[model samples]
Target: MDKKSELRRDLVSGDWIVISESRSKRKHQFAKKEKRIIVPRSSCPFEDPQRSGNKLPILIYPEIGKWRVQVLENKYPAFKDVKGCAYIFKKGPYSVAEAVGHHDLVLTRDHNKRFDQLPLAEAELVFRAFKDRYEMHLNDPCVSYVSIFHNWGPKAGASIYHPHYQMIAIPVVPPDVEHSLDGSVRFFEKNKKCVHCVMIKEEIKEKNRIVFQNKNAVAFAPFVSKEPFELRIFPKKHIPYFEETSEAVLKDVIKALYFSLKKIAKNMKDPDLNFFIHTAPIKNKKKYHHYHWHIEVIPKTNIDAGFELSTGIEINTVDPDEAAKILKKN
Candidate 1:
């Protein structure tokens, strides 16, 4: 009989993902170098966002000449900022609420340079802009959570070739995030320790799955990785809030992410990827002290087919250990 596939449950989210090494005949088969779409700068909206009909930037770095990063209202916002808080009411048997929130874009100056290719200083500045905008939304009466994410390449949902990130402040905690928060709190209550910090300690000790690590942060292919080459970055210390992260710790986390992305591009054949920050909710901050904030980087290496769609379980073809080995190579 052939060896059976493993069902690995995520430590933090409690979601189960199938790890079937037999799905791919060879290691190289897992590398799907997604084609890069090059939109001419002349036609790119981000080149001159104001001229391209975007709202004036809400915030800009350097306050003076030659802005390096700018945050502007998303031209096509999924959530509109209405006059009042989104209130839940009954629509017969269903509950309904106004979709009231804010959506913004953080754009970098160079069209050609993606996050991995950005200079360390410029990349850090990008995150600083995110922090500034996140802080701005903290006072909003309608906002409950803020999402910060970057989609690179078309597969990763980057419609425009110009590199940009998105921040959406919404009225309620999203279901996926809620699951993670619930799971982490449950673990903390039971064990009296942060779940992510425990996982980080194990990964650091094991070293098999670690992709990159600096003085204050570590990036690794998660043991229960839901997708091929899936990686997570965490501050070595237990930090529950992204906006409150100290400058020294944030720089190390940024360095870990910067190095990991470069390795993914070099070793994994430049596949399109999405990276997002996961932190405690903006409201009731004290209730989530047990949570440990982190970044999840998922390369577009696998698509959810029928099994995944029907079962809500992702089938990851590549083993995370092997993925880490490949990415760890110089």
Candidate 2:
């Protein structure tokens, strides 16, 4: 079949979404649950990364046998090194470019243990690796933005059961990030304050939407949550770059992240979740001072229907205040 994928724009939000009718299946097809098959340790490729044909790790912690956390080149990368920076060209009326960038995996030692299951010290190491690699990728001239994200369970798009995170450095800033940056800039122009910082202050005062907090970090269900059980973790202080955050603050942020995930597992019954960092673009440092770096954790609670597909708006079944109350109890 010919590829029938096209990008459609939402006039209200100015966001673009792919509409691929060729990829769609019957309505009942999505409801059928496949049997959860666990791949054995013997067949798991991450067991011995080097032995399994992966290149030597770019960064490894502990500097000893049985690595705790390691960063390696992705065997099957969505983006790869190219001769020059990405160049845009017109094909018919649409613009296209090469997928030139860096893609790597952050692997942990344990196959069964997820991020929330790891000890606090071990969990902190993961974020350390993320920051280190993020800074490294930012140095490249081709990279405009670096995305650091984790996917848990099959529903959240984790193909391999082995616990791992991914970093993708792309030439173009993603549309979602662009929209968020635009909103922050607009808010700051009018109010002369960071949008996220304002939200943090209100959330602190309200106290109902807070899930967990410490001296440096706070996690809460967002006031304008797009999905059920959506949670965001932000640094109390204004920070534009995730790579430039202080070690002390990052540790506290990681603690809040761990606590939030633990609560979700207990209260939501181990729902598949995706967590990712959203910060300023790598290219511009000063322009996005109004932006605040943070992490968004979205559980795979509901799927989009026809109405949601046609329109850009989401229909969240749970309220952020009630979601926070449930999470706080856990």
Candidate 3:
């Protein structure tokens, strides 16, 4: 594309997104206008997890008599723990493998308390659960990567209204992760430095795109934001493994995360969003030492229209600097 239709390459994934200034709309116009579809508490499956036919929680943290947060196997999982090792077999010209892995849900007790609304202590507990589950799945011989993510509203792929997070351990590294790993490796080989760390330094120096930061963690609107108000949170120290992070550092990271989400809710008019952890793959820790683990929070501001779907190039209307300015407001 031409300069007016700027194609920015993602530093980690190396994917190009077209920022078409020609097709740009007002930043405020991207705010969500739809009403959230609230599922009743009585019919919510996560209200009483066991009574809803869910298997007993693998891990439960009880506060008094009631559970504060619990980790349980998903009732309907996308991937299941099969008997044997996951194998790649040929179906004529195509190759496929059995989806042999683990899918679990980390659920909070309160139905109405979103991550941004949760108390700081409770939010920290949620990350503690994430680290616990991530470490648990990393031990599996068949697993290559574990993905921890949360979907907020229906548009962001939340089928249930109860606030919950999901962890999926897969036998192979996903394409997006593969691309990111490749990009990081290439950058490290050429520059001998972590790309994300470099970005963090630059963002800190610039201070224009910073949303929030503490001693241990920083959150900012990425320079190459794929969507409007795309915020990324990173620990100041370059750690490739999320599970290895300490509770104090994790609390700092979650604090930045909560701050980002709260700002997004207020600035974007409560848009649906998806936040996920991007860390080094479980099987190749040494190879990804130069990589940095972080969380990317993407607000569902626009749907994939014809151009985006055809070219894999997202069109972000709002500038990252503008987004940061808006989010920084009280």
Candidate 4:
């Protein structure tokens, strides 16, 4: 860190991360390894989900022989699907509650092809499965939020090399999401507009950090990026909830995502990455109408050490403008 280091705050979440020019690495240094680990298809659980000791799928497409995509209950779930609401109880000085919710895996038929590699129709089907499962959780009293995310490659926390996405219904809103929701509420109260919509407008005007854009959605590297190659995708219109989004708008968003990931793979040497959706909590839909829903893509280019772990502020090693410039190239 040096004088060139700048502490930039995120407009939507109000979190600060440092862009330290002194700590920046060369562009080539961030490229992924020449060979990514590949798990054998014969041993993949998703190849024959039922034979691998997984329960019956919660939902399946086509509902017949030779499934294209299916959603199954995670064999080992982080949250347990149990009856009754999660109630907090004190254990001496600490308070805890039951982790009652659903964790399911959405798997495509192809074991080798990742989500980004899917055909547009297939990719859209994955999202449709996400929407169906998400809506199923809406009636559960124990569920307060549903997180939809994908972890690509080993470094991005994909223990299984086969391509799959996860949908997790949780008893409470996560702290990071809580911070974002609270910040959105605060901004709307003060400015009388959606914070994310404002950022999207500014990004549209600036154009320097834009990676890809279509008529209804745009993808860009955030000015306050927390890591190298961090990108955010937002619908052009102000949409408060992911589940409520129309098919026409959602298709454009998926298209933008497809192009963005393709650019990253081509330009950044197929780096491992994690992407997750941020939306208003399922518990209070009306309360967060002022909030805008979007997706965040963070490539695993850097790791946290003592400083980042202690202070909770990330040291981004690449300038977002530079990142966008590289990704924007054909």
Residue by residue across 250-324, what tens digits does model 2's lDDT show?
A: 999999999999988777766778999999999876888888999999988678998678877565555577678
- Model 3 agreement with the true structure over 238-268: per-residue lDDT tens digits: 9988888887888899999998899998988
Model 3 clash pairs are none
Report lDDT (Cα) of residue 36, candidate 2: 44
* lDDT score, candidate 3, position 202: 93
Q: Estimate TM-scores for all models.
A: 0.97, 0.89, 0.95, 0.97
Clashing pairs in 2: none
Model 1, residue 172: C-alpha shift (Å) = 0.5
Better of 1 and 2 by TM-score: 1
Model 4: lDDT of residue 322: 83
Of the candidates shown, which would achieve the greatest lDDT relative to the real structure?
1
> What are the lDDT scores of the predictions, listed in order?
0.91, 0.84, 0.88, 0.90
Provide the clash count, candidate 3: 0
What's the residue-level lDDT of 119 in candidate 3?
89
Cα RMSD (Å) per model?
Answer: 1.5, 7.5, 2.2, 1.6
Clashes of each: 0, 0, 0, 0
* Stretches > 4 Å off in candidate 3: 1-5
